[model samples]
Target: MDSPNSARYSSRRSGETSRRHRWLGGCRDANPDNRSNVRASSQNIMSATLHTRESFDHSPVMAEEIVALFGEVPHGVVIDATLGGAGHTTRLLEAYPWMSVLGIDQDDMAIEHAAALRANSADIAQRLDVQRGRFDSIDTFLAQRNIDSISGALFDLGVSSPQLDMADRGFSYRQDGPLDMRMDTNAQLSAADVVTGYEVQQLTDVLRNNADERFAFRIAKAIVAARPIANTTQLAEIVANAIPAPARRTGGHPAKRTFQAIRIEVNKELDILPRALHDAIRATAPGGRVAVLSYHSGEDRIVKQAFRDAESNPLVQTVASPFQHHQSANKLVRKVKVAERPSAREIELNPRASSARLRVIEKVGS
Candidate 1:
């Protein structure tokens, strides 16, 4: 999503034309018998380049469930609020041919990538509208587009795989890169700023609340001491060293939580999410649906509470009250049930999807 004050970054690369031709040539020369290896090679080549359309290689988490929930919405525009790699948007568009998608993303690279994908596919290109903005501004975007209400909305929260795998983006704890983790590259705050600028207590709260890091205090202190921390690797190493040895051995990576914490703070992810959810619910028409695919506990908690609050609409109370004697009132959407997580098989195929939790709610009354 485009930040309010930040300058937009150029999406074009100098050798993009040549690189595209090279990628196409590689595709054409691949042997059908060894297609799997060729596909992997192509992905690697794509990743090596700057932010090309193909570089955003991400598998949408719980794609089937997302489609099932949103596809049934009556013909109208569906908002893909996150639009990471356009994975969920493409699936929804394909499943419900009548439904168009408004794909919103903070990352300009994602918008460019979606446009390129749209260009290649005639049907999707005709129906997909790529917009550069954050989900929190969903209402304003729809208003500017002259759209009144939407059939469905989908929010697949958190960073995409390409964002993590691309070392330069600095979302990954494994790879060494610049300490930049802004989802909207144009955003002012970065991981480096949080690490170097935040006071020890503030940093500790960020780590503790964002990721529930047990050694938040120790990690925060270490980061402060290591003040001029340069890149992702340096911060990751400090976080790892600060944590107790036994604790570090069991978790996937010691720096994983800390990195997630910093990234969340830098992006202000949690703060805006509640507003975005409310905007989505308000924008959706009666009987329409809203689905959220969240990766972390904090995100899920926010989603859960928002849905619960919506379900207990004041209108319902007003309508039922004897004193009010209201015949009809606008009833908000109710949560279908608890959130759904990916199965073991899906997790095996795409480990990045392991933490995904999908919660769906549908508009109930006029």
Candidate 2:
């Protein structure tokens, strides 16, 4: 994901190198145990632990369903527009070994990691064409690659586990680190800048718009008072201080909502999501399918709307009807099905995956 414009922060090399090296060392120690666990797990799904030394190996959520959804489509190309740890991409590649994939991501580390992982698997590595870009620019990316049609597409939206677990990324309010939450570190706007720069009204608007945080005004007021907040801990402490003792008793950490709002603002996540979904619909060939995995209300709303638009548009026929009619064009199940939540077993294994919802749509002929 090397970009000429993204290389301006060379001075931060020492810090990044130290952190990545530490991760690589830690990964080596856990490699055998993790690999053995993966092998012992259900079915013959290729899986591995993610690390700086290795390629993106984070496990996919709802992998079986994702692969199944795409498998129902015909042979051709598939696009993974949000190739986060390439978790879903890996699964997609494995399920359709004969199919080619154009995997895209804005994160430089993720792109590098995916490339490395692809190199490790001779079959998948050969079939993959990696690109570094945001999902919103799907059309431009496709044009650049001279790819106009795709059999299917998948977007496993939102942050990856590594981004959250790694303290330096500044995604999690729990980890003590800087407030820089840009998914693409190269982005000039950091979470710290948003927190310290945005006015109370602006901050409140962002919080309310992004996450519907009820205490947005209170949190915004606290943030403005705590100006010049440099790190994650400082911001988290101020947010915590804003919450009343009684309200904090039942709900989770007070800073959780504030941090989420700031991260969404920093990344322009909501703004790009709908456009990405539209581009995916346009790129998909007739009879193709698109699956989206969203973790929040805002993201799911965008997916829901974009899917509805695609299904209703005159250019594409809807596979499934709203009702369970016998003479439906494609099938009711192929229409925007009721969003499915992760199983309790999955939530038990990965608490972060609890809020995840899977949505699938199939495209009929124009």
Candidate 3:
């Protein structure tokens, strides 16, 4: 995979020009051979050398639900753990004028984009503090600031539409770009490393566990056979060809799951998520809320388990005396129900919101 700096240099040498546009750009190409051209055009719109503020434009999924959850909390700081494009954070700040937000994200581009937005809007600038780091280190950030607890926290999990739209970032399977998919540009491991290095079984496990891809083993075998896969388009083509034609026709895209699994592995997303949720619950004030918007079953499952474990002890308490026994507990922010999804209207407007599922929980005792 090419380094970001090199990608930028190459993009300029290729005579590409950046353009302002919304997120509806990259749909799958009908002609497999022309997929490379589609990726090149996307590259032109989001040149690696220049990421215009407009390039980060993304519509927050279930914006009203997020605002409602955080708005009900008493006045205090709110943490936006996955502050991609600051869409949710912006709405959150507007809804709760009395509250402030500490926005955290691993992506440098996201942080830069947020800073640019802050510079333009004085109201947003005054209330939002941007930080570049992973959410799992929330405790460290809080300690540095001498803060004890926050009123609420929001975790919007998975890749954002802007990231997918930017072909150089390589999150999209449909676009032909470098295999690099590190959320944090400074991160050592990349999707390219996983694709080029992982053993067949390891790759299979990643696909099966992270994405629930039914053809994990077959895909892994194909990936191994096509060693040193050059770009997203090539990898996608390989996976598509490896799958049974009938099966490939039904799913939205055959490469979607493989790309998701690779990105998850490269970023260690699932490994860090459990610790991040624990930190959020621990750092939140009593009665404070924690809301998560997950885009896939693997992420949703992790959130569900974390909420369940917080509400009940995994082991039975041996002591008979209730007064003597000590146990931690968590409360549901609202009544427990099936995770919320975007409305048909939202999906119609932004197809990316189709798979989103929102879940909320709260801290119980002090």
lDDT (Cα, tens digit) per residue for candidate 3, span 192-245: 898889999999999998889999999999999999799999999999998999
TM-score of every candidate: 0.81, 0.82, 0.80
Off by over 4 Å in 2: 1-57, 314-337
Per TM-score, the best of the predicted structures is 2
**Per-candidate clash tally:** 3, 2, 0
Q: Rate the local accuracy (lDDT) of all candidates.
A: 0.70, 0.68, 0.70
| Global Cα lDDT for candidate 2 | 0.68
Give the alpha carbon lDDT tens digit for every residue of 1-366 in model 1: 111111111122234344222121111111244334323313333232223333223346776567667645668999999986676676566556677899999987677767666656566577889899888999999999999989978898877655665678888778889999998988999988898999999999999999888899999999999989999889889999999999999757788888888888989999999999988888888767788877888888888888777767631111111112223333332223545777787667666666777777666554
Candidate 3 lDDT: 0.70
Task: Give residue 51's error in model 2 in angstroms.
Answer: 11
RMSD, candidate 2, Å: 7.3
